[model samples]
Target: FLTAPTMDDKIKREILPAAVNYYQKRRLVHRLNPQPVTEIAYYTAGGGCLTSSEAVLRPKAEIQRLRETFADGSELYLNFSDKPWVIGGRQIEPLGFYASGPGFEAETGRKDGLWFDWYGDADGCFLNARNYDWLMEPKGTAAMGRGPEGAEPQFANRGDAVVKRGPLATDTAVAVMREADGSRRIRFFPQKQMGFVSIDLAASGFEPAEVVALDAEGNPVAGSLDGVERGSGTLTIRHRDPRVWSFRLTPGKGRTGR
Candidate 1:
């Protein structure tokens, strides 16, 4: 629990609000009871020096096998031993980021993965990805929020809530959660200051002949869909509002039969 800052005015005014918001978001994740929650995962590599084990060139593949760690984004820890007698240096490829897939990457590697040029002060660092804020802090961060339960859940419940989700391609990270009621809770921070996003919904069984943006309280917000003029297939949403948006995708025009 985060208490309001009672000290410096700067701390009280600036930091407390953010803390409160984060706490509220965390509570929201808890309230989505019986749903599968994803917590930030940390993967460790580089114990080969002690055991003299084989070097691992593909830590990403190892992390993949440990999918149980986190369903969404996670942190990869690459440890480097500074021992004077260690041979060659424990090396591993942090595969959290790849051009073809979604994964984590160390923030320090702004343009590429962490590499040793042999002149640096030290080796190994706990990395926060460039998208760490989007992946961990935000209430809807896929890595920290609840996701649809998995197939053959070990403790499956008869009344657990369920949701559907689809992958999206965007310049930056976006969080999406499809509810049991066919509504969508989206967390998209437009890379551009203006509000303009094209969603692949509103077509077929996706829901609603038309779509509208709603605030968390279910009040309609000022927004528009390209479908009004363009057609149904690629519905583009233009809303200049908050980063998090909720939409009701019911009253669909998709296939109902067969």
Candidate 2:
């Protein structure tokens, strides 16, 4: 192949010239003496150059013979193809990055998992870095107090969890459930906080009704929600200086627009 002005220039300087010479000698000899010649291939243990897949499949004896005769960085062609050739094999190395632990929220009742990202300043590209969620805990705490899993080795988030999509901005109606004795009760939060927060409802069904925010204790906080037939139901958390938010919803019941 023709060399580009950039990367291929380095390829030409390092491996192509010698490979052309080696092939030329072989071709001349074949033209003069019609005897069969054994084809020898060289494989890169790590890798230095590129040619073809078959280049790395020669017998041990043949490969040794070629190596002993040629210099370390030599390149050669498979045949008389117009393509530029390199003698040595390719080079490979390990890939590297950074990892972090999971997160949990009390008010929202949602647990965020361990996460990871590439290590470096904001600029450099991460070669093969990926964003992953860990379901299990880390192995152990460092002597210096490091790692996300509470500085203790435990059955922390070790597996990946599926990313769940929250309800859309639109108001959607959902089911409401209460024990027959009214002792046990539950409520839905908006799509955003619903997974973690809970809302207190007077009853179910889409109607102009008052919805309030409640803690795990079931005591109602300040503020009320405007109920809608469609879209996620949102209740503004009142007491806290900056009001928190949650969805008013329920499952098992069919479609309620949010």
Candidate 3:
């Protein structure tokens, strides 16, 4: 039941041209595609960082942050506290107002001080005392290996451990990140760096992970950088994209791949 005026307003607000290129394969493309974004998905998926039904609020002595890590290594985080926290030096806003029911005690706990805040999946999305009239669209995935239980970072210092990104090694770059729902995933960049780059996997909080390289046009480079091995605090590589290269990270158990 969209009125003409409402429809017009939506068209004005939503129609962001995906690409400006008019000539594509020669047909003189006119209409551009809208980005594949389901605005209400997060709300429908139960709002604040969801976890499996079996997941429980971790012991106070175990994890210290509220995080939901997927089996694929992707992780999500949420903060309701006033204490400020930053992923890649960028401070994030806390979720909207919160209140609980009569018996609902706002129990708080932190795990072994490593990283991770766990909670049980209450029947459906926890319908805590949050304003339902307004929905929030969470943005920005954790920048890989800025040294937290965040994604985009697979393996940093192989044996040591990295808490923040250092200058020496190039970040685990994600060129065209496609979300699980097939939409484009957004990424954040840290301040510009100049000169040599060095990375120690363990120091940066990356586990042993498998890496694949993709070239500019999204084609995997068959055999390149064979000398690169898992970082054991001394690994070094040119700190920049190799002519628009994207690295794909997968769960690699041991020190195997090149």
- Overall local distance difference test of candidate 2: 0.25
Over 71-180, each residue of candidate 1 has an lDDT whose tens digit, in order, gives 33322233221211111242333222211012212211112222211000011111111221211222222332335333222111122111111212222223334445
Candidates by TM-score, descending order: 1, 3, 2
Q: lDDT tens string, model 3, 1-258?
A: 011122233233321111101111011111111112121111112223323332345332222225432333323344443343344343333331111222211111221221111111111011011101111121122321133333332211222221222212222221123224222211112111111224344432333344455565656667654234544455443323433244444434543221
Please list all clashing residue pairs in model 1, or write none if there are none: 204-254, 205-254, 208-250, 208-252
- Give the C-alpha miss distance for residue 222 in model 2, angstroms: 1.2
User: Quick one: best TM-score, which candidate?
Assistant: 1
Q: TM-score of every model?
A: 0.34, 0.19, 0.24
Candidate lDDT (C-alpha), each: 0.30, 0.25, 0.26
Which candidate do you rate higher for TM-score, 1 or 2? 1
Candidate 2 per-residue lDDT, tens place, 1-258, comes to 212223234234432222222222222232223323233344333323323455556443232212111222222223221112234432111110111111100010112432211111111111100112121333223322347754443322243222211211111112133233222222322212222212322122222233445555555545534232323444322222223232222332342311
User: Model 2 residue 102 lDDT?
Assistant: 19
Q: In terms of TM-score, how similar is model 2 to the real structure?
A: 0.19
Q: Given candidate 2, what's the lDDT at residue 186?
A: 26
In angstroms, the error of model 3 at 212 is 1.3
